[model samples]
Target: MSMNSHAAIAPSLLARIGAPVRRRAAFLLLMASLGLGVLREAALGDAWRRPVRAEFRRVLREAAGGGFSTIAVTAALIGLGLVSQAIYWLGEAGQEGIVGTVLVTVLVRELAPVLVGFVLLGRSGMVAIVELGAMQAGGQLRALQGMGLDPFRLLVLPRVAAFAVTGFTLGIIFVLIALLTGFVAGSLLGVVQLSLFGFLDAVLRAMGARDFLLFPGKLVMIGALVGLTSTITGLSARRGDSTATLLPRGFLRGVLAVLLCSALLSLAV
Candidate 1:
């Protein structure tokens, strides 16, 4: 075939391949756009007016409150399992001196953020997907626009911001509870001789500057992206999309976002 024929055939072939590819590409494109535009949208004069503020508050409460107990339980379980084992083994190996460093690196820098991200994703992110997706499918978003409301401003901004804030707050809570629980468990198991304060101090001192900066930032950004992916997935729902279709996609996308963000951020620091 001539080069021109090849070029012509390429377009036709691509057209056939584009449907599934384009849907994914569009979802990613929108997710990125929404993540970037959130702050800009929040800055708009009308973005955080009474209605938007109310929604933000409501979402913040729901996302944080719903996951609070889950985060606690998960953190405690991790403490009893991962943290206690690390402490016991390190003590056995006469590496108790590095306990802080290991825990900080594994728990704070890595496990806490990803685990907390999952907690937020499962607890509140799915809820947003369902609610927003239903609105999109029902044309309620367009209906709100027809009534002179900016759906992005009223809905997207508040929810995304709420999720971000909640992410950071819950992350701190998770770390503290996990560390405390682990200390208690270790002390009871006769594996840890250090006082609670000493253990906390050790963990704190083990933290380098990057840990302080990157960990919280990662959690915040992860939270924001969780909300972003969920909202975009939901808002992009096709007319006939049911929860069955929207949910799995939302979950997959959200999980991908969290893991990718965590990996990249860890690498960066």
Candidate 2:
């Protein structure tokens, strides 16, 4: 190909290549705007009317309903693998004094939020994607709009709030279970000699004032991000989108949101 011919074709090639990139960027910006809109609407008391309240309650139940068993199982496993192992190794190293520090810093502060976020994403986020994607595909969203309903107010706000609440709830449960399980395992293995109250005291002592604020805040943010990203993914579904496409997209986005929020919070604190 001559240089002149190549130049003529380059623009067309570039346009084609850039189209998807631009579309993705624009979609991300739209989602960000929608997230902000949800936050704003949720802040207003008037937005918590009967319909919105009902939907919020239903979504909350559906999202967090079976959370106890899942959290318990996951927490026990994590305690066996993470907490017990850390305590045993630290005790062997004669650095048992810092067990609290290590647990708080590594497991409670970091792992708990991320793990709980993933649980919520798997348990409820994918459901949101499927439900909303189906509604979008079936034109139910349009029908609701025609019926003078604001989908964002009715759907997005409550769901996001529920997710946030669920995230915090699960996160706390996760921390307690993991810690207690770890303590029990450690005691059984002869790695922990302290009483349960003493072990808890050590963990509490290791935590600073900032940690009290940061831990819960991290959980809330992780949950909100997962919920927001998944919801946005579903709501943005087009006519061509199906379960296969929406599910993976929502999962990836939710995972990224959870990690990113955790990292940012870690850096900030």
Candidate 3:
């Protein structure tokens, strides 16, 4: 083989090898971050606890104000889809009774968290990372340090708490709306018997205490993963000249981190 051909092949081969290693490293780092965050939360007792709690409250307030807008918009879109599916299934007879069950299970267990996380990733997480990156680049973080303020406490902590609370709350709301919309559509279509109690029973029976526990657990882990990964990636961006490349790479890493953490936790459950 010609040296030129070998060189080309080597680059492609190296790229293939590097991709998996990078993914694995990102997954490992995500797990480490989750472990470290959980440990810190446990060890600090009330020192960081009050601030985190306060930040979470603040986040909920902000989300209550602004999160509604996004939730409303998402609800409309999701409601339409759920309703359409319910109507279609209702035409098939007794399957309509399960519409509410399907909606709740899919929305609460899967769609809501994943969708809300992705939305916040784009809406909140990206903005947070960029803003913090810019602040660090402009020496604001350093200025705060000089002013004797802890950047972690002032910046990272609140955002982390906010993301967890907001993401989880929005997820729950999304699921509720989806189920309700499905139920209404099923009733309107006159398929089977549309009883809220029956639907609730189905949902409750399908989702055990373990499932309920796991969903929130996954959400919290995903929230922390997004927060820490974004922070580290943004901080790293300060040292680089390529904000464009760094931002996308950071976003992808953050998402992958969330998925990895969720998958690992699922395995343990």
Q: TM-score for every candidate vs. truth?
A: 0.93, 0.95, 0.77
Which lDDT tens digits does candidate 3 get at residues 1-269?
A: 89999999999999999999997788568557655765575457563666566765665576445666687678667866865465466557656556545654566666666666766676667766787788878888889889987777656666776677777777777766766676676567665364777766766676767678878877776766676667666665646636686679768977786666666766677
Badly placed stretches (over 4 Å) of model 2 are none
In model 1, the number of clashes is 0
Deviation of model 1 at 138, angstroms: 1.9
Candidate 3 segments whose C-alpha is farther than 4 A from its true place: 1-35, 38-46, 49-64, 83-101, 240-243
Q: Which residue pairs show backbone clashes in model 1?
A: none
Predicted candidate 2 versus true structure: per-residue lDDT over 179-219, tens digit per residue: 99999999999989799999999999999998998899998
* lDDT (Cα atoms) of all candidates against the true structure: 0.91, 0.90, 0.68
TM-score (C-alpha) between model 3 and the true structure: 0.77
In angstroms, give how far residue 80 of model 2 lies from its true place: 0.7
The order of the candidates by TM-score, greatest first, is 2, 1, 3
Candidate 1 has a TM-score of: 0.93
lDDT of 2: 0.90
Question: How do the residues 161-265 of candidate 1 rate in per-residue lDDT, one tens digit apiece?
Answer: 999999999999999988888888899999998988899999999999999999999999999999998888888888789899998988999999999999999
